[model samples]
Target: MKRAYVLVTADKMSIRKAAWQCGVPIQTLRDRLERGVNQARPLGGDPLLSRSEEEGLVKHIEYLAKCGYPLTRKDVINLATETAIFLKKRPQNAGNLSKRWFVRFMSRWPELRLAKAQKLSMKRAKATSDETVQSYFQELDRILTKYDIKNKPHLIYNVDETGFQMEHTPSKVVGPRGLKLNAITSERGPTTTLLACGNAVGTCLPPYFVFKGARYDARLMAGAVPGSKCSMSKSGWSNGNIFKHFLEEHFIPFLPQRKPDDHVLLLYDGHTSHISIPLIELAKEHKIILFVLPPHTSHVLQPLDVGLFKPLKTFQNACGARMRESPGEVITRYDVCNLASKSFLKAFTPINFINSFRKTGIFPFNPQEIDQTMFEPAKNLARNHWQTEGEEESVEKGNMEKLNQFFSSRLPTPKEPKSHPKKRKVSYRPGGVAITEETIILKIRKVYADGDDAHIHPDNSLGEVSGEGRKRANVTQEESDSDDETDDVCCVCNKFSPDGLNKLNYLKIVDWAQCDLCNHWVHLEFCDRRNVNDIRSGPYRCIHCVSLEE
Candidate 1:
């Protein structure tokens, strides 16, 4: 329309000719000409921040997100409030930062998005410290250079598994304020694991899915991609056997034809199953070199974990949501593979694959890609430890004694309660089995009630009671004896002797770290020896039950 008006006014063209040539109305062209150079009016009212200020804000938020501390909506609103106060632009009508304002604010910044923050434990955070990441890169660089696989983009691949819930609830929804709204979902079901493999150059192999069942039905693969395969596992998790099967059956078969001498480099996490003899044997037989990521550092190092999986999960949820909306549809295990196929097609793009590799410094090797700020928390903690030691050393012995004296004077002394003697004698049952605290308490009550057979022995461990004992009156005997297990075993080594007992005096003192996945305790030292690194900073898995991931 503007072009037609320009032609009519500037080129001496008639209205009819201009309208016919430019395919616009003559009156519309005339109106545009009269209006002069049409300017795009700002849709909403003047922005709270100027263009430069908004740009700076976007940069700041991005920086914070990179620093592992993405701001919440409330945090962003507070920051805006602070900015308004700083700029002396307080509007009388404005109360809290409006939701619409935030929506518009995000619209202006396309690259800046609201993402669900990944929660990291302090141990996990420390595990991804700057030094650890740099070490990983150094080792990766050495390995790539050593094997001359640095330029082998196609040969360099990352494989990771992710789980998709049958009824994947969307992250956000619209609802009225101050009212409860539950997202209606299908029946509760187990997640299906999807094993995805991709190269640094953006080539993706068909996904391998593991479902929880004894047998897989053909209907499960109905809408799946042509070459995709599905397997069944008891827990729907991958084990060494499944991993070996995937490498031999799916992975090796999907690779592009190459010379017998040409080998591929496969990068994966330090899951015990991945390092098993059978998996290693299969990889070696197929001329695939397995490079295991350092323990607890997959979040930053693995290409699939760093980038691809997040989008894949989001897309899967979207697919599940679409499936759910169909009338009378309830998502079952069969529907997941199809939903996953749709998600993989949408999310596993070339850009996502390549970017993940580049960002993690795996391909086109560059260690500087990882920011130093990611390791700040670990460094700060180390620094504070030494500083705390120095301050403790600076304190005088005399001052410490005086402080102790003052605390002693102020502290209330606990008094012993009066005991009621009875004719009943408590009995001692001797056995290798644990005599429950409940049994002892019952015998004590029997003695106090003047029961003749209840005799309390002086050698009994629970013979004495204190003033604080009354506080535990409501505690059940089973609850009291909960910690008296004589046969606790380590999940990894499956041994009992040094497993449950905690004694610092032991020559080789061992601490038990519970697997987050299986909720079974394994010896910390045993985990270290077995290369199970996440035991310390965990959401961990035992060797036998390590994730196939869903």
Candidate 2:
């Protein structure tokens, strides 16, 4: 078509001659020459959305994904449907855009692809920022340089604890398609805590086990590593006392002989159980440096969390599966030790220990080893909403405005903010601090001056102390009792009226009615009743209760 048009216009040839020379149809050539239009209309019905509208939608999708809120196939479909309605291109009765449209949309934009998103907690995502990680590395470098252990991989150690339940998580197995498959596991079991310590030089100490019981049992250590240490805790979880004991008894004994003044860098997360006056004092006494990773960053910064614990849990689950092959066998706390020990031996190899430290950028002291893309999710925390900048701004803004207006107008009004209980105040400590004699002395002074005996008494677990020297359990019980006294509060607005009168307007008596099904109190105004007589005339049911009946 271009050849025919060029021949007729540029070459000054007749329509018949140009069509004959270019092998084009005479009628088509005549029509094109007369109309003087270069491009022909696309060979199909018009698209539901214009090219600009589709481009805007694509930008919106990419912006959401970049903000760590990627849309699913159904989410895109619903979004498209809503967009079409807002633009008045589709009627409200039109259903969601089909999967075929989604496939074509993917093809239209080559940059987009379907992917499985990994789950990360909001706190973890927000905490794993470049600022937090860089600060941690800065402190870590100071400790390493001050102690002259940057070249000594044997002196750098990471300690962490993981839990193992008697009931194992089943792994995938070969089975017939379209048929249900089942893997046998214990019905219920108690969790056992395992504390592991490894160095950057690919060496590990004997695994330590903490079982749930008042008294320590010898049988729980059956089939465990030869030099493993076992202890009992009320909740089968390590506390400050257990951690202190592990460092003093197991960790120190297993260390290779070195000068008394040589410092060992012990890296671990800042769990309440991992920090105490006694633990800090012990570290100061021994030439060990206790370095805590930034809060909520263990998943990326802690060596054990980054590389070892995942495989350790997987291997433990496999071992538990084999043990379940025995008919009518129920794994006990005794079996947890055996299964965990097997997994620990497999996972805590020299190569794995070395890889764990390297992957976390700790062993080689290379802060640049961490991937920048891992911090993308945290970028959204610093911004209020996703903004399309650069070339996409003009294209996306108009459509986004319409869509936002449509949804905002129809969405229900937000509920009134409720008052939250006063949270216990905790003293903030800088991460990656090296516990030295001077630091320990300052901490002891602060504890005594502040009357914070929780840390001084290792037997008093963090959960027991309310940080204000009051029993946490007693405080919680009192709060619960106060909550029970407010049972007659309105469910809709959370307003309370003691004498059946509105607090805002005493003359306007607001009668409260209880739902017969849920037994929740509701204001007559919220129940679609103009007067208290209408509510008392019949048994009241809340909207949720009515929906449940349907």
Candidate 3:
């Protein structure tokens, strides 16, 4: 108990007070505190039983617990009876136990031990970039960039294909404006695939459609060839099957039928077939030049690689609109073939194909300079209100005045101050004259194919500079586009602005337009804004893309 007094005194109290509060005499507490030792309780004279009997009782209690007997006074009594009989044979203690019976004991007690304390070491490490293997393609890309085509125009074919499965992945989505906070989102999907192969001068080598069946194979590849192993994989989407089939079939057959000297140059990705043994042998034999782009560079390098796929997807979704009544919505192998035919035909029709490519801006040069855009959610450009089943145009809900007022808030508007007037400037230069134009031509810089940056002068006047020294016009959309609707899309990415539905006088940041199909901004143009042109472009997010390249 004196040990308890020390603990009490440790909490900001005198030993005398602690002892007093603990109801122990100061002298007794003082005697116990002479050393850090706890005293066993003093024994009183036990006239009831002897010490040997009490020890025997403890042993019996332990025996009863070990024997699976429930602890009770009766159990202890029976155990003691049996133990006493055993003790009759051999008794341990001969000491008097008259005073031992005065105390009580618990069955179990906790055992304590000392624990060792130690310290641990912590260190950090670094790693190299994960794309070490993929970089080899970059060198390959340089070789292709310099390699010339066999024929000037007609014989040069960028023959390639693509594939897809109907699967959706978890993707993060964003919300519209005006929320205190916007959370990310996810969605499920319908899917499709398109394969486009064509030449540099806007001629298609014969596009293929992607299907899930086994119609694609080595023989398919052989059929795609004219007579030799090298041919267009346009027999089907760019798959392992078509990859093999092209080397086996159409590749060499598609060679110049008329001009023996005419050779075909194939610009495609590094799919297995393009580099496979069969295809390689055919190329060497037939002198077919195969140019496969670098890894992660296809969307920016190939013409159809960017924006044309969106229309293909849109077409698939159109086909998928048919409801499935049974376990099969599977378009038959034949149906797939038919769909592939139609999709390729409609998607690659010369005019549509060129328009799509123009939108993507992959046509010219500087593949590294092209935008990487993924597909965007297709919006119905169809107006909300209609005249009736027979109506041709949308109903005008409001008057021109309201419409003008509504549009005024959407774009950067030219200002005429009502409360503040312009101040006259004081002459500072010795010439005594100042440049007083409200416009300044901003130079747009472009990267040339020769790896040099050149500036193109824009026709707009940069009125004032922001705090960051950046210049932008306060021009309204009505004044900027004047008569064109295509300019309503973003000039940087062909995406509708965050405030696009409401924002006015859309400003073009880069010299390009976004493809609605690809949903990316591309095709840096020198065309007049008054007569804007539409083109296909890939869209990139982390990187700008005309498609879901990453």
Reference-based lDDT, each prediction: 0.61, 0.70, 0.35
Summarize candidate 2's per-residue lDDT along 187-251 as a digit string, tens digits: 55555778889999898999998888798778899999989998887656666788889999999
TM per candidate comes to: 0.55, 0.66, 0.32
lDDT of 1 by residue, 1-550 (tens): 7677668878999888999999998787777666764434443478977675565455556645654557888877767665665556766456668787888888877897787775654545666777777666776676677667799898899887766666555556679999987765677576567788999999999889877778768987878887998777765655556777788899989898777777788886644333433455566677777776665566667788778777766554555476557856777777777777887887889999999999988788888887666775456444422121122332336543333333233222334533532222223322211112234335434544653322222111111111221121221101111012111345444443232333444454455555554545556554434433544464655555553342
Instruction: List ranges where model 1 is wrong by over 4 Å.
Output: 1-116, 174-182, 314-324, 385-550
* Model 1, total clashes: 8
Segments in model 3 whose C-alpha atoms lie over 4 Å from true places: 1-151, 164-195, 207-241, 255-258, 324-334, 355-550
Q: Write the per-residue lDDT of candidate 3 for residues 1-550, one digit (tens) a residue.
A: 6455555546756668777778877776666666544445333443232343444344333332322222454434344333333335224354322222222322211121122321111100000112321242353333334443322544455554444333212123456677655321112221123344665556665543333333344432322322222222222223344554544454454445645644455655543222333444556467565554433333334456444443555334423532123233543333333444455555665665455444433333323333321210001112232111212221233332332232223222324423522222211111000011011101101122322211111111111111121222222201111111222333342222222323346544433333433333332332213212332233222122322344
Give the candidates in order of TM-score, highest first.
Answer: 2, 1, 3
Alpha-carbon shift of residue 394 in model 1 (angstroms):
28
Q: Which residue window of length 10 is worst by lDDT in model 1?
A: 474-483
Superposed on all Cα atoms, model 2 deviates from the true structure by an RMSD in Å of: 14.8
